[model samples]
Target chain A: MSATAPRPNGAPPGAVAAARRYGEVVAPYLVLAAVWQLAALAFPSYLFPPLDAVLARFFAIVTSAKQFTDVLATLWRILAGLAGAFLIGGVIAFVMAQSRTMDRFLAPILTFFQGIPALSWVVFAIIWIHGIELRIFVIMVMTTLPAFTFQILGALRAISKDLFEMVLSFRPTRWGRFRVMVLPSILPDILTAWKVNLGNASRVVVVAELVGATGGIGYELLQQQQLFDMTGALAWTLQLVFFVLLVQRLLAWIETHAFRYRAASEHSL
Target chain B: MTAGPGRLEEPVVRFDRVTKLFERPGEGTFRAVDDLSLEIHAGTRVALLGKTGCGKSTMFNMIAGLLDPTEGTVTVNGRDPFREFDSFRGKLAVVFQNDRLLPWRTAIGNVEIGLEMLGLAPQERHDMAQRWLTQLGLGGHENDYPHALSGGMRQRVSIARAFATNAGLLLCDEPFSALDEITGQRLREEFVSLVREKRKTAVFITHSINEAFQIGDRIVVLKRPARIAYDVKISPDLDAAEKEAIRARILDELSA
Candidate 1:
């Protein structure tokens, strides 16, 4: 039986299903906002600003061209770093999957880098790189490379040998084998890695900006904090949250469209 | 077009003194196929009948070039499939025990894979894939993914994939073992008729005596360590009682 059986009442099931799913996602955020508002009622405004005050400041920042530029700058850095990490990390992962020698040589190195925190890299970048943009980019890439590489490697390893054998029986070229078998088999994993590293790279970009960068949301956040502008800090924090959620939603939308062939039960997180 | 009688006289597949050994982590080594030699002519349908772990799949893998024999030579069309893997690029196809359809691809997409490998034009591949899927009774389900199709329909898609390649040799590794009896019978009939009409050389691997009787032009019963225990040619003229007797004899040989 089809998993998405149409409703008996002749309504479009796709619209109804989408609405229900969106409601499920929004419900928790609404509840969390309510809880935050209640907490704001019990605290002083300077220490714990009300939701409305923070939101008002958030809107004010969003409307200002300079403040919006800060948001764009942070986004550009994160996207650039992540795009580089994805390309470099994807090549490394493919090499690791194809060759045992490469896997052995790279496994311990990846593990070592993974053990070093993003903050440590930010400091190292500050010492090593004079340019602020390069420093933030380096820190973001270092933070995300290991996770993307390993996730792609795991996806490569999880491909069934039986399927490979079946494809092999057709005697495809190495490139054909990869296109018809490897790429499709590991696509879900690649998308998952992209989602994970997007979140990670976003956070690391902010952290790197906080340390030494001249411009971005993190820089604005630091400035607001030093001046004891609690509402502004909270508003920037809200912007950060909104940025992360926006990226996640975009990735989710891409995943749903790209992997429409996946069963409903196997929907990605 | 009907396949002319006795058109396939040349030996297309040969196994000479073939042996395979597998090493377990702590269990040393186990012999999967011993020094067994066999030859199958072109356009002949042969069934290698054996139970699980009886080396039927191992033998199939040897011919498919996924595994190399440790002790002997396996040649397809006068060339070693393992060593000269590229030589069989468009000449061989396999229908695995499981459908093995790529979950991310629809029925038509899955069927088009071999054509894609063969470097057919997009329109040509699309037309070929669509025709095969439709011929296999999956006309309207071509857009469905494997998860959306039933077990039987998924197997049909797999069969369509193999046929779409238009390969000269078809290797079936228990292609219908996962389906229910009725579905299996229907697919087996369709598959047999297609194979005969196209005059393709086929090697079907199965553990069922009845399945062998139904589909095999010649049946070879394999004993453990995989030597041939019985080699019998099936004639279309055999009565029901004679067929039953042959099945009983094959079962006895397997049990022995």
Candidate 2:
């Protein structure tokens, strides 16, 4: 057949076409069901709760006002932390790019902070601010700064010396260079760093809250665990995972649409 | 002072006994430039022909003030370029072989960058940018990004950008080296017309002997550890056939 020739419905009809496609799609689920059945046969009830029990727990968490409130509180804290981190870390990264002395001075300190786990900072943050909000500040400073600095520095280094000469020849002012050259050229690296740090920040937020929060998803998980209800703890953990996945999907959408022009600009550079 | 502008018009660019050296591992020094001297008059187009690492780029860099000569002084438009970098930068534009258009900017955006550097008003910079883009036959491609354009088109944008700056000296280091023969030839013709119209003095470096013959008003050939081996001035009146003959003759002399 000619490559250009169009098929009638974009795919060939077959004996399979007469069958229900939805049932065909669920064939994989049938295999999964058989595996679950075998597991139920082999394993004890406590270790492996039936899929129905897990589904029931999922529905309960979704319908619970307290669970939803707890999740909202955690989400709010994460958003506040991310906002603060984006601004503070972005400025510091820019400063690092401009001056070698500043970069040298801060490099070791940042590396040291990044090497330590989020849990290590929780005690100090509580001592300093004595509240849940303090963890957001600590998380922003620790998780975001190092990634942001490294991303900006990496982008700066990846630029061609010849391209800089071309800029010099054009004689752009400091502002012009920033707007026309620096912002666009280093955008992809900066975005990648932001995405990486977003995940880092989210994970750290949970750790910080779980260790010390009074009223958030982590706090709820802690309370449930203290009450000896493993199902509630697992449900909260699943919710956190779902939230992270949702944010990632949202970021992907923004990158593809909202920031696409900036991405396009960087692609050529 | 009256005699031929008393070296005032003596030469727009001059290299006075310039020497450039680099150090090698377990070696004292590598002499890239050796007390080389030459004079190029205002509006003169000089082509420096040499093999790779023969110091053609180094010499050009010295003239462009990208590097200082190890020993002798170099001057452009009667000013020592190193003394005031900004002043020198104001009048000198370099076109590298890699058409380094700021990838972030559109074609006209790249062209207008010099005006922004000079602190020109936005309207005037935009107007000048538009005019130059049109002049270089890039009228339709002004808004196109560098990635969206072909190599020859990007080179054309580079040319437009270099010319738009109104620099007295244009230092081109194999600007067309990346292009195929046909595009290179067309660009050379376009370049000749553009330079003639702008009345800009230029020093072009190229490995292609034929390209030097086609675009140059004068040519300087260099051997390794370079000194100018031959200086030839072509008659401006020469037709294409005669220019081709001149190229063949110059190649034969260089090979010998």
Candidate 3:
């Protein structure tokens, strides 16, 4: 819901404001599409296919089960990796936040992960696990650790000592402190971190599938490229981009509502 | 219900030779608060006046149990406040300079947080928040975000939040310093009336002599480094003319 009101328990008062915000966002897409169509007319058809061709390919991918299955596979791998990362990386980040020694120990490891390319992990995965799922796992370990650890660390650091004092002073049960203070304070940052991870993850999935997958959009694209079907390759690439955009839009909706609820609750106080 | 709700006669927070020190790894020690001693009796409204960095906030922080004195102890109702942070919080409500309301929670929710932490039922907490919001001239604006509220209105919300818990000691650190002078005056009057209505003890730390005169039962001025230079009991029954004279005297003391 659009919670534009300042306080929590009170009713909201600004539907007009929300409508304006949506209008501001949707207006730009029309401008972008016009610009893209105009640019397509200038570029060689090989490098930049007509916008209609890309849209047609995107529609076909959306309609087909094969494309859906490939997309789902990539999503599943990312989700599994990220879930594990939150567990492992969250604990590590928390420990690092609490102790200087732990921070010192983990900082270099995280830096190394962020600095290295995801493709390198795919090579290692081939040597170690020698399979597509293993390659996906490698991508997960590489992308998930950096995003999860840094986001969590950033969240922890962003929380004010005043809030900590408030938690400590209230002497709420450990669970209550986490529920009331730590979770709310860190959520926006964690959500932002997830968005960053998704971008990386989509890229990682493409690399993983291109190098090792038996079936997937990236594998399909690689095959088309091998056969010198530039139209099919570009078509597959555009579909993948559209999928990433859809995920981003979904995350945006979730964050806006969640933040509004939180903001309303705070405003009431 | 009768007003001045929890007015009591005994001291609730006692700072006995509370000395707070800070030292960097290679630097000499800096005495933030030096051998500071004070007592806040219930129902008495006192102001701690000092220039910035004169240790007013440090003293309040120690009372709030956010800091531990390097030497001596802070006893809230004969118990070390730092020993049990939760219990200390229960007995004390603080309004910081920055109005440390949770940015995510609304005004009512902010007011109800302590009650929520106390584990009061959610509906009852909502009722209490509503009552306070209305009383603080924020009846219709309960759902307004902090950013949406004017500076003066936000202070009112903060005051309401502190008073809602009915804590024995209310520690306010320059809460109105950021406000315009006229609004600040109105808030001071409102605050004094609120304290009188609630009968709660308060430690209002501010640099404004006008504000000190407006709400303070007792004004304690701190000079540089952290010593209470002047302790004066303001007359509770000063008329407009008498208030002007008192204001002049207080300003003279401040300038000196």
Candidate 4:
């Protein structure tokens, strides 16, 4: 016989462990769905649409070409705004890292921007910017730019001086230094910055759409609100939710592969 | 590249009255090295032995082109290593106190760092790095990340990194100081043999008297603020008595 009793069903220990972990992750969400379904049985369809109706609407929104366009429009706005802010923030962060005067001048201004509310920027964008896409883009950038700049700045500051000096010892060219040392050092923080700003941008874009734009999830939600259709509201909201979840999973996958070199401890934070 | 043409008479490294001072926040100027002058000839192993705050690292930094001398000139290969830093791209290498391996890089990848800077072909660098790794007893560990290796093994990889570049000069700043006694001694022997075989000019900074004796043909003991206190030449033919006298002298200077 084996040293001890074999796993039930003769499954390998690793597979069993993986199955348990996945079950733990799914258990809470299952409970949440059950609770929502129970609430739907008691309340009217307008107040709390049944899960099956919500699922049907969610499928219709995904399957229908015109309806899916709104979802795609929102994603495009979010990505465009994030890409613009990330590029600008990276340049600003680099300048800040290089010069004390630039850092001192720009840091406070960014902090001040961070304090201004997202809705306030939407209002400002409505007043100042004429084009719908430009207005939404400006709002997205304003809301998320500071966080991107600050996070990247923090990462830049946190690079080990010893490691930097070691790479410099080889007398790398400026671009070589960046490709060899600076990029790898800052990448983890950059990914995390994208992860955070992606969420913030998604939320901010919807708000910008509601006020200044015509076609997006937020605009669709406006239509649902006027009609008082709970099913459409939940379904559209889930579409955005699904999109966020998909992107988040993609980011997580990248993190796993990119950071596999990291040593794991038996006890992790 | 060794010493530059017309500067053939000049040593590989010459520091003429170098003084490095730092201004700490709210503490005024703190002098780390004061009016220090030294010369290191090519193809020689010179161990710089000093106390904790005797400016060994300061001098090392100056020679490596990382720091500018405040008062005087530091010339490596007969050029200002700082002002003419880029010109020494593949001429010299440094093995620091810590291994300083790039965590994202494998052992061989870290070894290929200098070769990359030199614009060598990937296959050529890979072969050079692999040979160095294998010579350093890290043959199978070429693909292992720095975190996966032990301290001694990681230090070996760093040694491979410096040597793989085929740099004529190697500056070591207490590379084995953090290792266990046995492992440190073993690496020290391996390092000495490699240095001898390559015929590379080296300046090793350390505080240990035994290490100074083990690695250096000439040991230069330093006092506080970076002035040389004792400089002596040791011969291989010297017996135990001759070696003891030099050791005693180094001890006296260090205690003083």
- Output the number of the lDDT-best candidate: 4
lDDT of each residue in A84-203, candidate 4, tens digit only: 999999999999999999999999999999999999999999999999999999999999999999999999999889999999999999999999999999999999999998888888
Supply every candidate's count of residue pairs whose N, Cα or C atoms clash at under 3 angstroms: 0, 2, 27, 0
lDDT of 1 at B172: 95
| Candidate 1 lDDT over residue span A148-225, tens digit each | 999999999999998887788788899999998999888889989988888788778878988888889999989988
Docking class of 4: high
Best-to-worst DockQ order: 4, 1, 2, 3
Query: 1 or 4, which is superior by TM-score?
Result: 4
**Candidate 3: tens digits of C-alpha lDDT, residues A1-269:** 55554644343547656766888988888798788778779987776677788778777877888786876676677677766677788888899999999899889989988887788877777677766776677667676787789889989998998767655545567778888899999988888877888778778877878887887777888898888766678778776777778878988998987788453435565
Which portions of model 1 show Cα errors greater than 4 Å?
A1-65, A265-269, B1-9, B239-249
Top DockQ hit: 4
| Cα lDDT tens digits for candidate 3, B185-255 | 78878888988888888899998887787779888888666676777788778678977776676666666
For A1-269, candidate 2 gives per-residue lDDT tens digits of 68677656666656336445866867877898678667766887455556666557867877889778878888787777777766776777777778899899888887887787777777677677765677656665666677777777779778777777667655456776677677777776777776787778777777778776787777887787788765566677777776877887777776676343343556664
TM-score of predicted structure 2: 0.76
**How high is the CA lDDT of each candidate model?**
0.90, 0.78, 0.78, 0.93
TM-score of chain B of each: 0.94, 0.91, 0.88, 0.96
Q: What's model 4's TM-score?
A: 0.96
| Local error of candidate 3 at residue B128 (angstroms) | 0.7
Candidates sorted on TM-score, descending: 4, 1, 3, 2
User: Quality of candidate 1's docking, in CAPRI categories?
Assistant: medium
lDDT, candidate 2, at A129:
70
Please report how far candidate 1 places residue A226 from its true position, in Å: 2.1
